[model samples]
Target: MTDTAPQPIDLDALPEEDDHDEALTTFRARVGAFELHWSVDAPLSVVMTSSSHVGRAGVGLIEVLTSAEQRGRTSQAYWRSAVGERLRVQGSHITSDGGAERAVIVQTDAVSGLEVRSTVTAPRGTTALRIESVVRNAGREPVVLTAVSSATIGIGRSSSDLDRVTWGSAASEWLAEDRWRETPVRELLPDISLPFHGQDGRGHAGVTSHGAWSSGEHLPCGYLVRGDGEALAWQIETSAGWHADLSQTRNGGVLSLLGPTDLEHQFAHELLPGESFTAVPVAIAASAEARDGVIAGLTRYRRWLRRDVAGEALPVVYNDFMNTLMGQPTTEQLLPLIRGAAAAGAEVFCIDAGWFADPAIGDWWSTVGEWREATARFGEGGLRRVIDEIHRQGMSSGLWLEPEVVGVDSPAAARLPDEAFFQRFGRRVQEDRRYHLDFRHPAVRGHLDATVDHLVEEYGIRYLKLDYNINPGAGTERNATTAGDGLLAHTRAFQDWLVRVQQRHPSLRIENCSSGAMRADYALLSVTHLQSTSDQQDFLLYPPIAASAPASILPEQCGNWAYPSSEMSDDETAFTLVTGLSGRLYLSGFLEELRPAQRDRVAEAVALHKALRGELADATPFWPLGLPAWDAPTVCLGLRTGSGDLLFVWDRDAAPAAFTLPDVSGEVEVLFPAAPTDGSGWRLATTVAGLSVATSAGLGARVLKVRRG
Candidate 1:
């Protein structure tokens, strides 16, 4: 007789029992292909699991124990998973036997899988639970798979009034058998059709418009929209591309797909049957607080999650005001720019990319090792003078440093032989105009520390813009042993260096940029202040780029505006300025190039932004009204403050038509300027109970700042 012990078919098929009868809510079981355990404490639960086939071949085994919870009031959830060989639990927190709780493990059963482990302690007032899962492949065939342990929350009802559904193009067609139909959410207010482009080419279609709710057949994710009120939801989906999908009932939230939209980061493997893989998916829930609360909660939880796995800080928005180095900048020219920006209300004046030495520009790269300014550029005591000037302007001074990059012909490169650099193939590879520095070396860390220390102690530099301009080489093909994992190791090590450096200089802000969008992960966000969305400084592209930014990225972190450039029109420029007002504003254009009227317009816009800064930072973008057309006019509407009661409208064209503010009630104040050119020149239209009329006639722009009376 065959020994049939009823083996589990899949890891999730494992039976779990809720022991509410016990003093501690405990759950322990050996599921189909793995072992799992969980316990709950009010709002949170603790879990632990162990499995050998949890990843691909040559990948290490995964032993993770974590705490998961649904936070109350805040409308957020929390998760902290620690990965290692052994899982040890003490009360609510879990750690590895070696106490290396924050380590990340790469596992492969038949294919590659990554597991990041960490611990989560309950927040000050919340109750908590512990949950853990061990997933393994008990089959003989290699399997390419994406596995995620997810917790979903459904508030109120799950029907049409509370939930709505939409499908991607592929998913929509597949569901056509069921007569899947789509309606525009903006139809109720036809005058406010949102101008947006969906993936592929089809515009957004509301799948639940007929007051119905449905789920995606293949994807396990879904959406819910409240009927009378607003609805907000967040989901972390893992496929070939890891993405965090944040959507709401009123407007389409953000779908932040990792890597590039065109490129696929597939977690493929030839699974040898019994091999298993695990992906951690994080989901959070909250009431309708304009989604800002959701973003804040998620930001907090992500920070906590990353801290548990890696003891580092995430990036923050450290705005820089300087332009890129097509050429060198003298202290005299740079100082005035910094001072002017400070006077213009910039908190941080960053001296951008060109501050360092580059031989191509007639000046030899001098500061790569010294971290001091080249005297020839400043005439005397360059860096200190610049720093002092920034302080005098009542703003923080920041300097850009690409520490991981070394110019091949630089003196620093000549002094440090091939051993100190990362080599590809046989010869030392060069990406762009620089060679990579091996941060894994202790000597390298020491050098970076010293360089940062000099800037902090000598010049009172409080912000550092660290730009990684190159990609990683083939680890295995580049060098044997752990050197193959240099990309991973360097990232981890660089984070460590950041933590240590920040500890020594607690006030210093660090912004990370890898040619722009690269290296923007939860791991890096924890340690730095901001991540550059792109290298291109064209304001024309800011709207689309910003529209794509996920809610996970705080309004403050969005890199919206660069500088005062002439490439864009006054209306286009105004649009860009308005978009940037919602995020960290960085200036890059030369003020000297602006015409008198343009300068005045720029100054007024900046002042207006300052006045409405709080509202712009706090409000959520509903739908974009259309872009300005050559024939007709265009307007952009946004809700500002007052729990959906206030509205802000921007007339983007020379000729403005009447705009009906949507869903606004009570007495409201409408503000617009008589002379659009005058910063302080405004004409107070009537204070109306519901809606008001405003007009614009000339080529400039107009802003209607409406507030509930």
Candidate 2:
């Protein structure tokens, strides 16, 4: 190892190999503001010595466990695996593009016969480093890959000082999404004073998502911060199931990330000869500031990774679901609703469900496959009239399609091959009367492709709300080695299919909805246009869900529903409309039944969202009152855009409410409804810290556009 200053790397220049025999050597690469230094042993086994963030020194050692099963292989108490210093470097290189540099290091397992390739990329002017791994089977026989590590790095401190660390994770569900809380490392893993307590830390903290729904269980993200403002945030960008583990290493703390495992999630992918499986990508960002700084860096990295998508203006969509219609949409029922949605300024009118269901059959869920217009429900002109009416109102026509599922009773179910659907022991894995379609099969993909192509070409559909309702346990064991392996392959194939669908239908705007927000992950969010934040029907219970949505998804792509009905109070209508305006306006409810005044409130919110929606594309979110608690009476969400700041203040308390906003000083004006005609006035005053806002009415919310004057 040399004591020379770090030097800049030229992409065109050849990298000088620091070849050593039975000796320790170091390899260095300058990526943006961070300097990555690797310690390579005699067998080319590399260990990250430092991944420094600017002026700070690198913290944490990445643990690599080589064995599929955890046996006593190494002295390191990191895990239950026959681990070793076994990363043999085969080759390495550097590439530059779009103000970023990527250092690709290739490694191989001599005994196990697995080729592991690591890509460490860093964008210019940022301290964020994105790391991803790909594992390929290079053996003669089949190899079962139980776990492929995305990242395993220790925190930059001693074992005794682990008390200074705080860990954060988000618990997500149907209505209760994005509930984040922090816990101290000392409390999570108590210090063990015994010398024979095994060198590893006392306990482990981890999060895992099971089945097809990636975010169904827990969010694939976590953050570790020290009391001294140093923080490390990471996210697993997988559409399928994944996990992130943080445990005690002898040094400080170690973090390991992977897409499922044999022990957890019934995941063991058997790789045939010459077959390679690319693990889910995980990103880690270092910030010397705090948890907020770490989140901001990770957000930027997410944006950079999503630069290739067919992104366009985020449009306000109206679906005839939720309280109104509720999946029973006929031509007669949808025509007026479509017209009303357009009148309310909705840019897309999606006919959700029942469109393909036969009216004769009471239940529509099971008879789902062949996506034909049920003539019994639609009448003479059929569903075309509803779509034409939507276009007539100057809105795009969107349809709901659960393209991956086929009912056992469905006509198409019998037509496709047995391999097209998920099967176990030569039997289809049935869940809730629906058999999950295996996207890995060409026949399954062909059926979905035809359905999408027909909808887009025939009906002139510009938008698609792709929904997945059921979770068929692990996956199919037929035609694959492991059920988990089969699921992972299908997940990857589904993502690839989405890209191909976009390529074929370039202008189609897809909304990723799984029952609700179950499958909301970067694997789909990175490619899809929008995400349905939640399916919470109670307007009172929706504020927290909508407020916390930006933490899990991009504000521009979060389709928060504002399902206002004619049966609600004026204040209640305003509250729901405000919820929709807070994120991407996903208008629902009985718009056709609303009175002029109620409709006007909805229109006002729509107008306000239209004015602010453009800024949402580039806006960064900040919570003045912290991330919304699921049961919090009052919630506030702030979006800092290029133009100005937009603050959403909700008063769900019994009486009047006041908010102490952070870093906001201006003459705040209620942008929606122009002036409050309901006799409720909002008072805004400047304070030393920020701004003080008090609303006259309770059980209401307001969207305030801040102007510093």
Which structure among the candidates has the greatest lDDT?
2
Per-residue CA lDDT of candidate 1, range 1-709, in tens? 1111212124343323223354233333332212223323222121212211111111112222211211111211111122222222222222233212211112222222322232222221111111222344444543333223233122221112213322221111111111111223333212222223211111222211000001111121222233332333333322112322222211222221111011122122223445433333333333333233333344444444444333122221224432433436677677656655664556667776556554345744433543556666676766678778888978777887878777766777777767567765566656656677766777678778888998888888887887655553432123322232333345456667887888888888777654454444444555666656555455443443443332434444555554655565555555555545444555556654566655665666566655655554455444233222222243343434543323334443455456544344454443322254454322334433335445455333334554454
Clashes of 2: 3
TM-score of each: 0.58, 0.91
The lDDT of each candidate is: 0.41, 0.76
The number of clashing residue pairs in each candidate reads 66, 3
lDDT of 2 by residue, 624-666 (tens): 8877777888899888777677888788886887777877887
Model 1 TM-score on a 0 to 1 scale: 0.58
- Name model 1 segments beyond 4 Å from true: 1-164, 167-327, 358-372, 414-429, 473-485, 531-536, 547-550, 565-576, 592-661, 664-709
Error of 1 at 611 (Å): 5.0
User: Which pairs of residues clash in candidate 2, taking residues 3 or more apart in a chain or in different chains?
Assistant: 60-154, 70-80, 70-81
Q: Mark the 10 consecutive residues where model 1 has the least summed lDDT.
A: 207-216
Lowest summed lDDT window (length 10), candidate 2: 52-61
